[model samples]
Target chain A: MFYFILDILGTIAFAISGVMVAMDKKLDVFGVFIVAFVTAVGGGTLRDVLIGQTPLFWLKDLTYIVTIIGAVIVAVVFRSRMSYFKRSLLLFDTLGIGLYTLVGVEKGLAVGLSPIMCVALGTITACFGGVTRDILCNEIPVIFRREIYATACILGGFGFFILRQLPLEETYSYATAILIIIVIRLLAVKFKLALPNIYKST
Target chain B: MFYFILDILGTIAFAISGVMVAMDKKLDVFGVFIVAFVTAVGGGTLRDVLIGQTPLFWLKDLTYIVTIIGAVIVAVVFRSRMSYFKRSLLLFDTLGIGLYTLVGVEKGLAVGLSPIMCVALGTITACFGGVTRDILCNEIPVIFRREIYATACILGGFGFFILRQLPLEETYSYATAILIIIVIRLLAVKFKLALPNIYKST
Candidate 1:
């Protein structure tokens, strides 16, 4: 039940971020909606596809559609106050990724994927939405260049696996995984931790 | 049988194009291979996912991986002479999209999607590889801003449906549809026919 709520919150958070980027790019309303929808679901969709899951999670459930629409409306109405809301938005976004990483890892394990593949899926789920959003908006994906986003997810996935081997309850292990992701992300942003540039510009 | 050969050729063309882009961006070897692989199979993978097909077309086949690797190696070895091969590459690419459009439309129809959705799938399959390629390379999708690329695929899709309704042989109708797409694309490039800008610059 908590996971379900966290999934919805993450979808809204991702959709809002997508809206912000689309608006910044001056996309048409249709384009904006498309971008937002892709941002909210792209990661999970990719993971589902990779695992041979059919119809996709969003297509099977209309709630995601409704939530994205609500997010779009909210973003449009509060466009003027977007800058001021950045910190709060970031908080939601962080929590969203935290929850999503655990969800993705669990799904991978359920499907009997290898441990490494499970971690990769978790990272992909947490980061690919923003990557798709930036691509549609015609920018380099911020996660590829910015502070430790996907890395935190990777670490959290590892943590989830490690904690699961302990004698603790599944819920506690999951919560610990989520917490590890959230704390890592918060620290990364707070301290400006980032991966080194892969390509050195001449 | 013919479709299989055309699909492989298309994969090679797209992979070569991806290698060119990655090299231009100065990405490392791993990045180059990744970009190439995505460019070759990204479109069909997306089409398959959307239509509830899974395991992805490329994953089930090893030929695609080998073809992309060969293309990448050739691209790197012949980097300095790429400009001279542009005409040949363009020819192969045109054929690739023509064949891919029909393949996508056929797949969609086979899955019992609506006619309009089938056409959309055709356009996506023919063009989205380049879109993914550009996105991974951190550029605006050339399709979104450029010439009549996707338009050709849409027109070809309609042509397929129209021809299917006639008394023509199945092979003839399919051939006609592919020919229409190739001719339209060739003419568009030759005459520089392009869609009007969505956003008029001040």
Candidate 2:
């Protein structure tokens, strides 16, 4: 139940971000729809493919597709009121990052991947879709450049692992993971935090 | 030995196609290199993942990376001369489609996939990267709108399947596949052929 709610929230966040990015490119409705679909579903699709899941995730869940369409409709209809939504984007995005991290971690565990592999998968699930979206939009991914994006995911996965090891219930562990990710992301944004780039001028 | 030669030729064709697409985007030298790398190897990577091949194609053969880098250098140094090269892009692209189709079919057959799935994989191998490139560049996929792109690949795959049942050797079978794809594509271009859109006006 928690996972389902978080998943939808994450989808909404990614959809809005995608719509915003398409707007930057001055794309039309179809273009916006494509971007939104890609942003919301791209990471999970990649993860599923890597895990050799057949038919892919969206094929299994109609709700995800419907949510993205809903997001695009909402964005388009509320274009005049977009400015008011700007301040809320960060909060929504943080919520998304946390939820998505948990999803990746849980999926990785379900597949019996090692803790290290699970963490990597969690990070990939949280960040790679945005990376793909930015790459397709002809820009470097913001997660790669700023805001401690993958780091937040890693911490969230660790939180899940630690909480699971304790005497806490499954819901408590899951909530802790999401909270850890969301709080870390929010703080990073509030404090203007970033990871050091691996590539530097020689 | 013929498959080896055809593979190299196909890589070169793919590399050139990637460079030409990058040129269309007016990307800088590094941008062209990255785009070339992605374009030439993206489909193969996806294939490997779907087939449960670990570590991926380019990761196994570093030669693919070297080939793309070499193509990028040739493209950058001859940017002005690349205009003349555009005339050959279609031919190279067609050759690439044919060769990749053969590779996809052979790989799928090796993995014991159904003939229908093999044909689909062949089409994916031939056109998925270009679709990806167009999507990233904020345009509708050329494969989606263009005249008979995947159709040519399907035809080539069918040619391979038929030739395999004949008295011909594997090399001839492969050559027949390539010839079928190239001829069909060239004729399609010459005749201005197209598929009818399924979505009619509302």
Candidate 3:
């Protein structure tokens, strides 16, 4: 039940990011919807495919599509009002990353991947959609260039795995993972932290 | 032998397109190579995943990566001279589309998809990388707005299926499909053809 709620929340948060980019580009309605849908579901779809899950999640369930459309409508209607809540969007995006990272790691572990691969999957699931969205928007993925994006997810994934080994409650473990990720990410952003660029020549 | 030759040709042509785009964006060596590799194989990767092919093509055959790197290096070194061959890029792009469409249709049929689905897959395989490239470049996908882009692939797929039912040789059938696609696309471009924009408000 917690996973389900967080999944939907993450999807909504992702959709908002996509919609903002689309609006920034002055994309038409169809374009907006396309961007939003892809942003919301792209990571999960790639993860599922790599894990040999067929038909994909959105294809099987319409709720995701509905939620994306709902987000789009809200964005469209509240375009001006939503501008005032830019910080709130950041909060949701950060929270979504944490929630998605946990779910993705759990899914990877459920499929019997090694802990390393599970962490990789978790990070990919949290970041790849935004990567695709940024690529589609003709921008460098902020996650790729920014500090503590993938790193935060990896840390949180490890945190979840470690907590699972303890005698703690599931909710507590989940919340701990989310909190760890969110705190790290917020601090990174606030401090203007960045990973050193690998290719210094360019 | 034909499939292998066509595949290599398509890879080279697609690699050139990627290099050109990267150059236009003033990307460094790594960025150029990344774009070139994705452009060369992105469509096929998407198709393979959709069809449940494991490990992905590049993972199975590292040569594809080597080939794209070679193409990118050549383009970078000859960037000024290659700009003189703008018409050649058009020709190669068309040829790549023709070859990719045929390969995609064959793969779809091999996997037991319906004829319509096969044609859809063919069109997707031929144009999706370019679509991705354009989107990443902050432009609309030519396939979505161009009247004859994906249409040519669909027609070619249909031609292949139809010709196979006749007494034509395999080479003849394949050549016929390629010719049909190339001719249709070139004529459409020459005539400035485009799909009707469905954006009522925009």
Q: What is the DockQ of candidate 3?
A: 0.11
Cα lDDT tens digits, model 2, A1-202, are 8667767888988988888776675554555665687788888877888787754556445687789989988987786677688768777778887877777888899999988888788888878878877776668777767668789899889878888889989988988888988888888878989887676665
By DockQ, highest first, what's the ranking? Answer: 1, 3, 2
The lDDT leader among the candidates is 1
Top DockQ: which candidate number? Answer: 1
The 10-residue segment of model 2 chain B with minimum total lDDT is B193-202
Residue A75 error, candidate 2, Å: 1.9
lDDT of candidate 1 over A1-202, digit per residue (tens):
7778888888999998988887777665545666788899899888887887875666546688789989988887777777788888888899999988877888899999888988998888888999988878777789888769999999998998899899999999889988999999999999988988876675
C-alpha local distance difference test of each model:
0.84, 0.76, 0.81
- lDDT by residue (B82-172, candidate 2, tens digit) is 7786657667677778888888888888877766667767877887777666655556555545467778888889878888899988988
For model 3, how does the per-residue alpha-carbon lDDT over B1-202 read when each residue is reduced to its tens digit? 8667767778888989988887888888888888888888888887878777767889989889888888888889998899787787788789899999988888887877766667766876887787777766667554544356777887899998899999989889888998999998899889987544322222
Candidate structures ordered by TM-score, highest first: 1, 3, 2
Q: Candidate 1 clashing pairs?
A: none
Off by over 4 Å in 1: A1-53, A56-131, A139-202, B200-202
Clashing pairs in 3: none
